[model samples]
Target chain A: MFEEADPDLLPEGLSDRLPPLAAEALRVTRAMNDVLAGHGFDPVQPPMVEFERSLASRMAGTKRNRMVRFVDPASLRTLALRSDMTVQVGRIAATSLKDAARPLRLSYAGQVLFLKGNGLEPERERLQVGAEIIGNDTVAAASESVSLAIEALKAAGARDISVDFTLPDLVDTLAASSLPLPEAAVPAVRRELDAKDAGSLVAAGGEAYLPLLYATGPFATAIEKLAALDAGDAVASRIEGLKEIAAHIDGAARLTLDPTERHGFEYQSWFGFTIYASGVRGALGRGGTYRITSEGGHDEVATGFSLYPDPLIARGAGSAKIERLFLPLGHDRDAALRLRTIGWQTVAALDASDDARALGCTHVLDGKEPRAL
Target chain B: MFEEADPDLLPEGLSDRLPPLAAEALRVTRAMNDVLAGHGFDPVQPPMVEFERSLASRMAGTKRNRMVRFVDPASLRTLALRSDMTVQVGRIAATSLKDAARPLRLSYAGQVLFLKGNGLEPERERLQVGAEIIGNDTVAAASESVSLAIEALKAAGARDISVDFTLPDLVDTLAASSLPLPEAAVPAVRRELDAKDAGSLVAAGGEAYLPLLYATGPFATAIEKLAALDAGDAVASRIEGLKEIAAHIDGAARLTLDPTERHGFEYQSWFGFTIYASGVRGALGRGGTYRITSEGGHDEVATGFSLYPDPLIARGAGSAKIERLFLPLGHDRDAALRLRTIGWQTVAALDASDDARALGCTHVLDGKEPRAL
Candidate 1:
């Protein structure tokens, strides 16, 4: 029957993770989640399907579009599989834990399905592990989140992860300034700034914003450079916030400054960041400060980061091979279970003639003690 | 704003699990996975979405219908979210692990979303955890699966769990018997046998099948009762198989026999089982022996069991309450980081005037000394 109906012909962009690889993902998720828990980040689980209307409010405009929607048979409502988990966790923080405290910490890890893969990330479904801190958006909170992100990556054995900080709100300040560019030039100006192209910025009639564009490097140097620019109060406060965060970030990781980089994050109006690990392709994950408007017309500060465990699993960092002990045919069931209770992987031999050691077993027992193969 | 577009207004039947509940689910899943692993069951992760046609081949017709389907934008293929994980794992063990070894052992855990709930279990989305032994569907395999399921439930802190065994193949044997019955009598015969109504069974042209129904009880009693029946090889083989399984399953848990209990599992050709823990609502999960057809025109004996942690989590045997340590404004970041390294949940104070003790903090550091609140 499998010949005619082989389910091995999987859908494009979908996959089955077998053996050690699967074990690796689970291991990495647990390690990262443990790190978050150590920092007071609680855990949350959000269902895979939700009404499309309700799903939309959970994420920003760009991220929400990637959700795969279907009509639920029972309710006749359009349901969407979660594309992002932060939104769902935020939803919980806003309602379930709304009155618990001034600041709340929560962590989560699960799979998220997308309508399509973005860029080079080909798998449509991904393993997402994340942590979010709600109610405080100050520099101290930002530093704590970034620090924890670095520590989580370390726990997952990610090497040389670079936490690059950005000012997602920098463009708004520049666009409304004295050296105002026409509305049509905004797109080109944004492109040049993100590219860190000083020549292109000047050529696009944004010559006055060159100092800010040049302020891209290590924390202290960039802040000094940014201070020299003719910036508005919004931009200045953001810089001041960065200084406070810098004071609190005590040598846990290297921090780079990319003052004008905004991709995959349009809702963030304050500090934003992306992390890249050495020798690993693409950013591991990104997170930063954002304004979370509550149900009562009030705003709260939120910051957190999510790490994709696939890369870590691909690098083979999570789990170890299982050691096995074998029992010859008609072996004692109690003996096998007893061996298992002490954390031994016991295999009951189906045939007496079968060589247990040849079957990849470490030890064998046949009423003659567990002897090494 | 949340008032205008609160994501917390989730779609019907979809909900968020916060704090201790989420941690509990994770804990239970890990404990169960550990038990399976100790028994030589390897872990596998099947993606959340798959091709509908391939998915259909993974489950029985009754379950396949409950799978939620949607169209993929890129591949233009009709994709379905996994309503069941057994099929995906089966697909892997048949194809990917096809040549690895005989009698392969694999385990998995993940979330499943259905088009609609089955029976009294109304939650459209459910968490599934299971371990499967492929290539050896012998009585030993069945015994191991049942024993492992009981061990897993205990590892998850389930109380007084009971495993109920059934002969799903008995009905087909009875239907193909020598006696001829009216079409309308078929339902009545099945009902009588399922209810153990020996009198009704005689009236419905099923008098010859009464012994199998009357044999439902504990293992030794059931086999003794079955021995008194005038049976063909087909009916006699089932009783013989049960006896072998009973001999192998010792000191695991209580086991009961139900010869005519058929629901949600029509694909199984032989032994089928469901597990329930006392003081817990609903069956934790079910599994049994089935013919897993290989790619090369051969059927391998397969046996496995799945356990849902939700019921155990509902019983509240997961993670302990999270403890908190508050650091006053401008406290040392290194001190906070060091404290967290030792399993302390460190939360930095956001406001100077805020009462750290009243904020659910068990300890605080305010320059004077580190003191318990």
Candidate 2:
């Protein structure tokens, strides 16, 4: 398919991150991970490849299509590189930490390779940084995760992130409720809600769901708009849980509410959030509560978030600004050590004929002192 | 294939590096890359997957077998996950940086997945950290790269590393020399040399190659022993070049010489060195002078090194020691901020019923005072 491309070129949707940029990505990842750790989230690294059973269960329908799979030469079993980290974290919580205490806090940051890219990020491979707190169903757990996500993003230098909170299982809840969406009409109505097409959703779900259409805006306005509608008891309880989570968040980031928002999020369940950096077009990160099923098929509650910091890194945060100091041939090694200790990066001249500047040095050692050239 | 193992279990050769270990690996990678960058090695992160042509050439024989490969869905061409960074660096040196001025210094660190682990490192995936100096073949360039490698290892907390120098292509060099190694006996003699078997090499290649057997142990004894041998001009010139590179290195790491040693390294053209940390069983790293071939087949001289810092990181570097501080529900946010600014990792209590210490905090804040609980 890439007939015109050089064989050495990267596979489509993949990229090669170089200096300054590579360094930037690392910096952002560390900053966010450190913030998670500060909040009692311990880091866990999963393998790049895992058996399809461990990685594909919760995300079976959607994730399986994007994973790069192959037969393991040693084991001869089907193996796939993870397209996402959430389900893997779930698997980890279920298996490795199976016997651990309640509310297990785990954090991770690594590269994930997708066979195909999604609409938001067209790159097949991306660096994903995330934190998950498992086995807690309380609104407090959801609130803490949300606040920490904002703090982590802020630590990564993302300013003015607007968090749009929504019910992840709203589509399922509506389908089960008395909304009378003949199984065939549900997909169309869900698509309209995902598109935020007000008129179209009303035409599909009818007049009773009009409040869902008006439920887009600030949390204060959206909650009252939703309160005005007669959503069944089952849906009402979910909305109350959303309210509790919202009330507990202390406005660490810009907070908004979109009750009927349901697209792009594959695993979120109870209270999901989509975060957008001020000027960036797509969501910077996503997180929510979801049911974690154990290897024994017993399910429990969990909440967490995953962030793709490329957009934050794109704005040029945390790049190295230090220029190197060159030690010309025959320069004192002791002097170079002293210069390096005092914050100058030392690049030694390899040959007597080499010019320091030509060798990419910004400063050169003259006698015992460094002089800017 | 994994019929008896749990579904969540990793393949036999893979592993999950949790918390402290994962953090340690990242720290060691950053430390080594920083040292490389200090020496004018601009960082270049190649894609995790590349066309087999870019990664397998030059390393055409040995590396191809170990690479985990598949047909790319996008390109419809065979693609392989990189098993080694050395050849990919060579490709970068050839294409993207073709016009990069003489002595191009580049550095990189990333995860490489292998189809099967080498005998030494049984894990299928490893973090490979390295730096390459392309374009100059002078002894001074080799010296600089060696010195920088030791300095980087030191930064990563590895102690007492010894560098054993050997000519990578010495067997072939001797095979082509006036010393008649019977074409049939060459492979047998080479195997003996690899095993450090002096008696076997003396039997096959004859008594003339006795010094090759004697050229073992510390650099002082081995170099003098080899110099005393009746070696022809070609071998003598190569030894002299080794001596020149030696003169430039000031013994930052223990130096030894093994003129006949040739095994894991298949890419080195001249002046190859293997690194060993005291008490570490396997080679910590390997690097040497090599010739680069562009896509058009134009050749250029280059030298560099690749380090497997996982051994160094195994010794507890960069694991966080600071315990988190717990801010109980209703605790003052300003007080928590003050504590955080003073090196405390503050984890806020999510609910009134939460026990701070149970949530993994060492100290809990009460009335603006943090108390050990």
- Report lDDT (CA) for all predictions: 0.77, 0.77
lDDT of 1 by residue, B250-271 (tens): 6466778877788755677688
lDDT of 1 by residue, A1-373 (tens): 5335554677767787777788788778888888887776778998998766655664573356688887777766677888878777766777777776767788899998888886787789888888888877777778888888888888887987777889987876678774577878888888888787889988987788788777888877988898777576777788888877666566666778878878856767688888888878888888887766545454577887777868878787334766788887777767776787778887776545555665568887657467777
**In model 1, which residue pairs have backbone atoms overlapping below 3 Å?**
B137-B301
TM-score of each: 0.91, 0.92
Candidate 2 segments whose C-alpha is farther than 4 A from its true place: A1-5, A60-62, A118-120, A174-189, A195-205, A230-252, A317-320, B1-5, B60-62, B174-189, B197-203, B230-251, B317-320, B352-355
Q: Scoring only chain A, what TM-score does candidate 1 earn? A: 0.88
Question: Per candidate, chain B TM-score?
Answer: 0.86, 0.89
Q: After superposition, how far is residue A26 of candidate 1 from its true place, in Å?
A: 1.0
Write model 2 residue lDDT over A245-359, tens digit each, in one string. 7776666666788877766556677688999888777898888887887456758889888888887887864355667788888898888878777677777767676677766
RMSD of 1: 3.4
lDDT of 1 at A337: 69
Q: Model 1, residue A369: displacement in angstroms?
A: 6.2
